[model samples]
Structure formats: C-alpha cells, structure tokens
Target: MSGKMIDTRVTIDGTFGPFDCRLDPRLCYTKPWFPLAETRKVAARTQYLAYKHGNSSTETIHVIEGRTDGPDSVHLIEGVPGRNGTPAVAVRIRWKGARPTATLGEATADARREVTRKATARRKAARSGRTGAPRAVVVHIDWCGLGEDFDEAAFVVEPSADGLYPVGAPEWRWDFASWWCPACQDSQPWHEVTCPCGLSRPATPLGAAGWNAGCALHCLTPEATSVLVDLDGSARIVDVHAGDTRIDMDRHAEPFGQAEEILRTALAEAKPGELAATGWERAPGRLWGRRYQITFPASRP
Candidate 1:
C-alpha cells in the first residue's frame, strides 16, 4: 500500500555549512538565495521529524504545488537546530490546501505527546489483561514505492494487534545476528567465543548483541557468524538460527511473551511486500537475560 504524503518545510536561521547563500549559475539561472534557504529548511524539517517521531513520520517536501496553488493553500513552517555547520534554526515550510493555522513545532509536540499517551495507555491495558483494546507493537519495515527501485525503511509502532492472541504468548527474544563458531559449527555469543579446540575468536556483527553480557565487541563473537541462544528446554522455542529476526521490546514494557505471540501470528499471515508493525515493543536492553524466538521471514528467506 502507498504511504501518506504530507507537506513539509525546513529553515536555517544562520549562514554556514557547504551551502552557498548566493545564487548558483550552474544548476539554474535562478538566484541561489531562495533555493538555498528552501534546502536548509527541508534539511531541518527532516532532522526534526526523525528526532521527534522517528524516520517513518517524516513527510515528503514538495517544491511545486501539484494541485492548484490558490488562496486556500496554507503553509506550515518547521524549525530545527542548524548543527553540522548549518544555520542556527533551520526552518522547513509545507504548503497544504485548507489546513488549520498551527506551527510545525506545536503540531509535532502535540502529536508526540498523543503518541506517548496512547502508547502508555495501551501498555497499561495489556498489563491489566484488557482484551478489548489491542496490544501495541513496533516494527522496522522496508517500504517500497509502487514503481520505485529502492525501499524506504520505516520504524513504526501500532496501538493494537488485529486478533491479539490466537497465536500464543511470547516466551523468547530472538536475535537476528550472532556469531558462528567454525570449530564447533554452533552459534556462540558475540563478545567471546572459545572453541573446545582452544581457538579463540574475536567479536563480530553476528554476535555483537552479546556485548550487553559484559561482552566486548571483540570478545563477543569469536567465529563471526554465530550467536548464543536460549537452551531449547528453557522456553517454548528450542533454538534460534541465522537469517532469523527477533523482536526487541522495552524491559519495562511488553509482558514478556505477548509481543512475540503477536509477531508470530503476523508473520504466519504476512505476504510478500507486506510488512506489518503488529505493535510497538520496547527498545533493546540487556541481551543474555532476554529470550528470543526465530522469526519466520528470516527463516524462510
């Protein structure tokens, strides 16, 4: 499905960075002042959205109005810090047709507050075993435009799941990348891998997640393609494997297995090009204590 296309603008109050304030004769005969200003404004807005609502919430900036540029059109300006040698307060403006008058800062803040409020309420509802309301889940998805060659990544959180739990509760926390010990041919923790052959390997991306267990990047994954998983007998899942993706949630959020169950169901029903958030979970916390289940997408792919 197509995503929402909201208008946006960015502004930079100061003069600096690689931007040339003067008009450039290279791209076009038009003066560079207005174009440069618009560029800085767009940059600022993009950064602000990413910081406030994450990458998914950022809207596409339009240079020209595809529709009629009539009196009914309204413009919204967003202000952002001009870090990285840019303007002090870079502003981006969005021209939308028939919208209320509100500053981007005000709108963004209100939206963020609402998101937090809703997310908190959903979490509370889940904790209290309220089945009427849906459980929240967050996911990282690669969205492709209809005919576009590349994909855009979106990290999003939903307030509820379709059918909360026809699947099951989450009992494991799956890690996608771990280290593989060549000698043992088994997944080892990322920080350190000590093979029975007395061969010690360094940390690698495969097992990088193990660093939280007092494991260093080099000390984590010895082999480089494997990782340590929960013992099969411990959780509902037996073992986690490579190419398998797992859900990471807030330590204080998700009741442990609930998020996993929602993901399991969504994965079971998901079609190609269809990435669902299921709901938002927590951010990554400690690694060892967390249990993970192997994701179907990575497994099948």
Candidate 2:
C-alpha cells in the first residue's frame, strides 16, 4: 500500500472517474458474501456523501471483514457487481483534502467589519459637515423658448461656504460675466480674449455686457413685428404672435439702439424696399422671436 500502485476507479450515481487508492492493512476485514449490486450502490453513495461534505477527492477500497489482511486480500474495484452469493465486498472510503465549512463566528465577523466601515465613513462626513458626494448645480437658461428649446447647463461642484458657486476661476470676479464659448461650448469668463479651444471672443454690441454678454437681442414692436439681432451681426425680422413683455428695456436701451441701427441700415441697403415688403417670415413658435443672420458693415475708423 505504501509504494505499490493499485488500479482504482470511482462511481458517483452513474458518473465514473479514475481514483487513487491508499489502503491501510490494519483496517482490513474478512471477505464476506456481499451482493455485487448492493456493494456498488454503497460505494457510490459513500463517494457522493464525501463529495457533498466538501471532500475534494475520495477513494473506495473493496475489502472483507478482517482486522489485519495483506494488500493482496484487499482489492480496488471498478463498477464490478459480483453475484448475489459471491464474497460480499465491504467498501472503505477515504475522503481527501476536505475544505472546512465557514463557522457562524466567521460570518458574523465579516458582517460586523462591513458595518464598521460604513459607520466610519458616515462619521467622517458628519465631522466635515458635508456629504460624500458633490452637489449638482443646474443653470437652466431659457432663451425665451419652450420645452425642447430650453438650454440647460449643469455643474457638479463642491459646495462653498457662500451659497454662490464659482464658474471658471476660483475667485469670482464681478467685473466680467460668464459666457459660453461657441467653439467648445464651455463656459468662460467674459474678459477671456480667447477660448481654450483657440476661438477668439466674438464681438457684441456696446453695453451688451453682464447678464446680456452672450444674449441675442429680440426687438419687439407694438404691431407684433419683431427682429432678432444676434451678437454676430445677423438680423432677422419675424412676425411674433405672443411673447413675454417683461424685458428690462431701460437697462438694455443703449445696446438695443445700436443693434436696431445696424439692422435698419442692412435691411434698407440689401432689400431696398418698404419695411412691410421685406417679406416678414411668420414665426409663431418663437416665444422670444426668430433668429436671423446678417452681415454687419465694416466699421470705418
């Protein structure tokens, strides 16, 4: 049994595989009359139980009822069911390398460790007077459009002591307002000459700074006629049916005058017809007004 190799086989239910045999002569028994079918069933059941109990490998040896028998008397069998009256073969199974199941204490300790980690994190956040996650600040700018036309910009930032959140720079500057860069669509301070994407700041009408830094002028008349003048010097006249009339006309009067003059001159020279004959496009959906592009005359120094 120590050095000699014995041919061994294992059967679980009906599955079969090669088995390595390790027999001890001290546990040998005398060969009794065992029904071949019953012996096979017992051996298979023993191997299955060893596996279900977490044994990685198992070996079943056929032996008779005896205290000390030589390895010759003990035989390693493979699916052989002898006759009913034949010498009964008792199976001796040895389970190898079984993994111990986890104890209740170990499982409880793991759960406790997880709870402690979460408690520590919550305590840290409480001490700092902040949640672990940063808050999202959504700046919804409605350019007088409804539903799908509403533009929304969101910023995820760490909350500051003051309720106001800083835009581009760490220190907020009141002199310049934040404007969106046309090239990259990133918000930048108004005083920035060039965007990070290398796009130069577009020119705006005089006095069109602060909140109106990147605003398009929507000039409305009492007759429901409106002209939309963009910062790029493009103008479009559209007939507006309904709109908000709470515009800060007094604050934007100077910029409106400059934008209106540019549009008036461009229309007169380009179309050369009555204002009504210029073909006002109907724009009922334009809550603010329709935006049109026009070229500004070169400034003569």
List TM-scores for all candidates, in order: 0.17, 0.16
What would the TM-score be for candidate 2 when compared with the true structure?
0.16
Give RMSD (Å) of candidate 2 vs. truth: 36.9
Tens digit per residue, CA lDDT, model 2, 126-198: 5765422222221111111212321221112222333222222211111223444422445554445566866
| Candidate models: Cα lDDT each | 0.28, 0.29
On residues 206-243, what C-alpha lDDT tens digit does candidate 1 reach at each position? Answer: 12112222121113222222222342243222232333
RMSD of each: 20.3, 36.9
Candidate 1 — which residues are off by over 4 angstroms?
A: 1-131, 137-178, 182-301
After TM-score superposition, what is the CA distance of residue 201 in candidate 2 from its true location, in Å? 0.9
- Deviation (Å) of 197 in candidate 2: 1.2
Off by over 4 Å in 2: 1-175, 204-301
lDDT of 1 at 78: 29
